[model samples]
Target chain A: MTGVLLPLLSFFFAASIVSLGWADMLIIVIYFLLVLGIGYYLMHFTKTGDDFFLAGRKMTMWIAGLAFISANLGSLELMGWAASAYQYGILATHWYWIGAIPAMLFLGIIMMPFYYISKTHSVPGYLKLRYGESSRMLAAISFALMTVLMSGVNMFAMALVMKVVIGWDINVSIWVSSITVMVYVVLGGLLSAIFNEVLQFMLIWFGALLVPIIGLVEVGGWSGMVAKIHQNFPAGDYTHLWSTLGHFKDNPMGIQWIGIVFGLGFVVSFGYWTTDFLVVQRVLSAKDLRSAKMAPIIGSAFKMMVPFIVILPGLLGLAVMPGLVGQNQAAMTGAQSYNEILPLMMARYLGPGLLGLGVTALIAGFMSGMAGNVTAFSTVWTYDIYKPLHLAATKREVADAHYVKVGRWATFIGVVISIGTAYLVQSAASIMDYVQALFSFFIAPLFGTVILGMLWKRATASGGFWGLLAGTASSIGMWIWVRIDPSALRIIAGSPDAKAMAEDMYRGLWSWVICVVVTIIVSYSTQPKAEAELVGLVRGCTDLPSEGHLPLVKRPIFWAGLILVAFIILQIIFW
Target chain B: MADEKLKSDSRATDSPERISIWFFIGAVLLVYGIIILIASIPGVSSPEGAQHVMLADLHAGIWWGALLIVLGAVYVAIFRPGRKKD
Candidate 1:
């Protein structure tokens, strides 16, 4: 704790003085200090990389679930996601009720069995155990590539919003957002992330849950906006929801409904909930297997409700923004940075004092998310990579002491690299689109390896390794193929790419198929590595008799049950 | 019935741990209810643009209704039918 206590004091001293005269800043400061203080205190708990990563595998299920949900829900989930509403409309978040909710519930019942059964930290660790060293290495590389790299997106988005609100320079906001996040995270590791998550979660919910009813009154209530909506966008064209809920009706996003659901919900959610390192680190830090599985499951269930707070605000925002409202239909549609839309509304509407509070809320969200990521980055490096090569300590011995100094250095180094890379990537344009697209690059590719590695004994590491490369390349290739040579894809896909609608439908489907095919082919060709004591580990996991080591259920009842439940939920959401 | 006795010293692996459904529901609902009621104090909705309604917080009375429904579903799902001991 002394090791943690010293650095955090200096960090807090610096952050407290960064901004001026914000009463809310003081409130946010209290939160910052408490989290930092507790995080520093808990450094006593982190003995090894495992403790740092999984809270020494001692977190209860409730804390694990809340922390997991809160970490995911940060500014990205709240402000940025709701701002998606501000930019587009409720249709953006309609995915929650339809796509996200079903995905989360299904994740708990289906994926939990595999994850808890593995008893590993991070998805890559699971691969290493089931597939082999080769697969583990690939999974790690892809995890770093997808999860770590895409994190720059959220950081960049938070910084951009700060620029809009306080008129702070983007680069300055970037630095402030990055440094503040690393401050507590480097001090405490996952404990800091978890503790801070408790506070940050409350702030986001308060912020998200606040905007709509207030906005509704400002916008002339639902009735006033109802008139304005009809005057501008024409009947039923403004929202897919108005015409037919959850089904697209001439919306510009043009994403096919099926693609949106499966690609975003199943593949993307699976990757994030089951595989993505940042999210996984949250689950990994859980006290035990039940907490790990239930964290995401419950987290997803919590997340499913977020649309009420975020997405609905966008529809409400339309009534207020001069850009979206006018005397006539043609006037409402025009060019603007939708990213600026939310902050602009806040600054214009909330008055400077309250506006400062909103900025502080975003900063809190930004810090919480950044801290979670830094914790994940540090955990993987120390546990998965460092301890394995350098230390000869026994597992129990490894599990019982403090490594704060090493952990802090890991965080500092990760932050520097991330900040440097984010600056380079800033030129790409549209912070939300760029980051999301980049996220898709890694998450889509690794989804196959994560699932196969868990479910099959034959999923050798060499296969896992090859499968990851193939999946990543295949996904990237699909992206490029769609953009550059849609014509070339027509032959392979047996659909004409010249048609925009065809291109849209094919892109999501092809990405999924390509990744899956490559993983299976590569996995099948590789010689299966005889894992050391495979049956023993599996038996120990299910706690079944030693002979069969078979799964607890005779058939795929759990997965089937989940799919049925998902179908039922989807029916209600769509019906 | 056999599964009932096989308890461990782990929150993650043990049988369903009871969560405070009331506290969770009450906190979110109470805050929202108070806020909406206060706003309807007939003065919080200041006319800024086309017309404006300001909420010091996000929660409102309706949010209580929504949360109760969701929380109820969550409670029903997590708590299984049977109880057991270590």
Candidate 2:
């Protein structure tokens, strides 16, 4: 204990000023122990593969909804978005609203019935049911790899936060967080992970709420913050959401509303919110069809408010910590830069005890993100990769206990590999760039295939496979083309001012277009499956039950409408 | 008979009908709130190793704690098994 304390003390001394007191440390320690305890306790409930992976298909709407957002409430959503807000101004909120809300609504209203009725364990499982083994294999392999890498990104981001705020060794932070996540997830599976996510969701709100509230007070109010931003950065349009977004050169984001609406909102957003198994898995865990549908709607409601916790801090950082941006300080040096805005705000505003909670909230965000990725990876590996191989070789169904064991082993192995990936991320130039590139490669094409297969009955299995392959290949090809000749990127993105993010959106849009066109042309040439065979898989072939029996307020459509109205109101207000 | 027993056991253990997560959350909030409130007293050692403190130091904990406890209670109340409609 003394040995441990000595190094920690020495590291603390070497690091910046100690922001946490003994009481704050006690609170953080207590929170960790409670999480571990919950994970261990939930393990006893997980007896089979279904229970382990899908929580016995018994999650309520609230649980599914909170977990859905919490799984995504990673350091990237909090810290990365805050950092983006600092850079791009309030225009970054479009990623939350236009980029997320409509897609979530589409998922709930249009996609849920297919996902729920099919009873597929994973997203690739859905592809297998809709398309064929070849498509399934392609998707499964890519998704499995992507999930693990994303987990590593989360791990890296978390370590970066700890290094910045607490002055801990990045490796130590990675191992500690990885081991904790592994223990809980390996023990209790998805249920424990979701449970902790819900807890983390609450803590995040509690921890981050103070920043915006205190900031608004200090800056006088919304009007005052706006005035400060305008006065300080005279050239930047930090307040307007859509009015200035006529073209790439017109706005701070350097992308037009077309990119925001079509690329991010339509292609990338739909691709991720609709098809990405990381979030969809939570909804799939819902006990009933209605609950599953309600989950994303609930999540969307919470998601609409997320810019408050995430982007507001960045805005405040702009007003308070002037000159924090454009510094490009190395993360390891613990220098206060734009990326450290969230923690810097907490350090300045939050006193000792609350500061502990704030730090814990950031840690919770990172851990939940890592845990969500690891759990998804383990499930995808076991169900999609390992089980398929095992079945092909043995030609037999394994016992539930056996699959459960494989899931646990996969979780352990996934975390270990993620630690390595985390180190790679640590060495990377910028984690945001790396993650966005991966998303364009995987998510954009996956969405194109999924949406086409779901909506178009004539989409052949061969078409699905080839189209996905082409889309992914094209995205990579485009990226390389741009990299080789910097001028080519200007042509591809349609703007000289297009940054990496704008380039990503354009790439997603072009890849999606390529995917859809290829799928249509190839599908016409290939043999199509019978309409009867495609029932429940295709949109028009299936008949969904009327939801009219429910009360107006209780209905998913009603909530979706209310959310849409709220969205319109926000757009108008910010316009 | 054995198969029937196994099915019944599985059904019973599969998923809890009532929500208990809020209860746990409430308990955590109550505990944290009490601890912070206790520590905020004049005699308790400040985490920053200071002898004196201000109302702002304890303000966040007390208020946030109270809010959490209330929210947890509301969740527990609303989600308790008897209130759930099929």
Instruction: Highest TM-score: give the candidate number.
Output: 2
| Alpha-carbon TM-score of each model against the true structure | 0.73, 0.92
lDDT of 1 by residue, A1-575 (tens): 33554344334333211232233234344545555565666555555666566666666555566677776666766665655665555557655655455555555555655556667766667666666666666556555544455557667666655554554566776786677667767666776677667556755665444555467766677678756665655634444442342333345444445545665556665565656677666766666454555566656656666676666566666665635432134335544445545555554434222333455557767777777777777766665666555564554435334445667787888788777667756876555454555566666557676666555656666666666677667666776776686576564345342234334334444555676777677768877656554542332224422323536442333433554576456456533
After aligning candidate 2 to the native by TM-score, how far in Å is the CA of A318 from where it should be?
1.3
Cα displacement (Å) at residue A311, model 2? 0.7
Q: Which regions in candidate 1 have their CA more than 4 angstroms from the true location?
A: A1-22, A145-148, A217-228, A241-249, A322-336, A345-357, A389-405, A426-438, A486-509, A522-532, A536-575, B1-86
User: What's the lDDT for residue A490 in model 2?
Assistant: 79
* Number of the predicted model whose DockQ against the real structure is largest: 2
lDDT by residue (tens digit), candidate 2, A1-575: 43564455456423642356655666677788888988998888899899899988888788788899999999767988898888889999999999999999999988998988888998898899999888889988988887887788777777767876878678878887889989999989999999899888988887789888888888889999999998889988888899988888878778888889999999999999999998999999988888899899999999999999999999988887777744446445545578778888887766656677788888889888888888888888999889889999999998989989999999999998888888887677476465657656978989999999999999999999999999999999998898789778778888788876788888999999998899999999999999998888889998887888988976899988999999989999998
lDDT value, residue A65 of candidate 2: 89
* DockQ per candidate, 2 decimals: 0.08, 0.16
